[model samples]
Target: MLEQVSLFVHSMWELLVSKHSEGLYNSVCLAVLLVLPLLLLLLSVCLCCQGCCGRTCCCSSCRRQQHNRARRKKHDDLWISSQPQPIMMESLTLSV
Candidate 1:
């Protein structure tokens, strides 16, 4: 099995490198050239989506901002709770 695998690999390498395989080599190169940019574009789009679509990315700034937002909310809640409430007043008509 190992010998068969090695023979296959050796034959493939020779085929790829031989002068008779120009068409095969051109096809392989064309495929790589065409696919590489698309793969890179996909990777960039996925990364951008992860960063922009309310998802956690591989950065500390978003985490820091999240913590800051939570802290601000907590502080605002405490401040609001501490404020005086308005008293309910009925009609105060003076009797003549």
Candidate 2:
């Protein structure tokens, strides 16, 4: 087991060294290392803003919906009240 572990570590080290010798791998690693923190920072800021502003954003939509509902209710009430009542007809006589 010890020998196997050492062999695995050696192989991994060799692979890393070979990739690093290519130059591109190192640059890629450097770019990822640099960009990763910036990305994480941006993500944290976005999450913080969302947590802080979520309620306010939701409240704005809620207020708009409430306003629309109130307007719709008012319009509906007016429309219904404006309709004339149906007159009752005692009978309809048709003479041929």
Residue 62 alpha-carbon offset, candidate 1, angstroms: 15
What TM-score, over all chains together, does every model reach?
0.35, 0.40
How would you encode candidate 2's per-residue C-alpha lDDT over 1-96 as one tens digit per residue?
999999999997787777678899785896697699999999999999999986575567788988899999977775455668786676656679
Worst 10 residues of 2 by lDDT: 74-83
Compose the digit string of candidate 1's lDDT tens values, residues 1-96: 999999999997685566345776776786687699999999999989888885746588888988999999977764455668776566556679
Badly placed stretches (over 4 Å) of model 1 are: 1-22, 56-96
Question: Number of the top candidate by TM-score?
Answer: 2
Residue-level error in angstroms, candidate 2, position 33: 0.6
